[model samples]
Target: MTDQPAVPTDDPTVLTDRDLEVLAEQLGREPRGVVGIAARCVCGRPLVVRTAPRLPDGTPFPTTYYLTHPGAVAAASRLEAQGVMREMTERLGEDEELAAAYRRAHEHYLARRAELGQVEEIDGISAGGMPTRVKCIHVLMGHALAAGSGVNPLGDEALALVRDQWRPDRCSC
Candidate 1:
């Protein structure tokens, strides 16, 4: 039989700004920034290109801007689910579903964090505690996504209690 072209299974080529914007929309948040892209070969492994800062050698790093692929998203979602599970195990303890959701969200946050690195604090406090450098981006992005998804991580009563104590209007004044 004639040799059929090898089927590609990589993540996909680098994505354009527009592509990133679309992914952001799917995520219900603004695209942070373009870091790099990756392509998955037919074997389904990532061929990554490092974007943004260049390597010392000055050769453009492989694939940074990855084309959006269903497999990639699915893989990300799975990792996120795992992270959520880890958090729940630590915080809530033994929650299968909540932990799963948290893990899923966590995976997404970790990926984004890898790309964005640490962001400046937003001048606020979360129920967990004051923001710290290590997990600042995770907390902020989690809050944003939770708010956007209408899934309040903090119950209404807890929020109200916090609000009463730290009223923005009064606190600033």
Candidate 2:
């Protein structure tokens, strides 16, 4: 992994017009409930988006941090196809320390989401299949990028694997 720039967690609270346009281009649809930017690429492109707990239609959305960068998403998909999530989940079961840390990550995610707003439907649930299994690398990496390093072990691992393809140090914008 390369020496990447630190992802400042203190991001913009609201998405700008350009942010929305770029996000739409990246996602292939209009982004819904995007409350803030959780992380960005070195070129200042939006990488991770923090969503609202509930949508305008009153649907409870659980995924707080959404990964948007195409390169990073593609890389994470490659790892997922390689069964990285399964292996990481197995590792979580074997390593108590890692599991504990992951649980904390889950807690941190919940707390952060709580700061935005609380939807009782998703009170303690954290996104990206946290605290139990390694489900989605996109979720994990988004959480890692948004929360910074040393927060999500599996996320960190996924990020390390994708560094060659998409590192936060260099902007692909």
Task: Compose the digit string of candidate 1's lDDT tens values, residues 102-165.
Answer: 4444444334334433323311222222111112222322233223332323221222333333
Show the colliding residue pairs in model 2.
Answer: none
| Cα misplacement distance, residue 16 of candidate 2 (Å) | 1.0
Error of 1 at 122 (Å): 22
Best by lDDT: 2
lDDT of 1: 0.32
Q: For residue 38, what is the lDDT in candidate 2?
A: 88
TM, every model: 0.27, 0.93
lDDT of 2 by residue, 34-148 (tens): 9888898776778899989998889999889999989889989999999998998998899999999999999989988988899999988898888899889999999998999
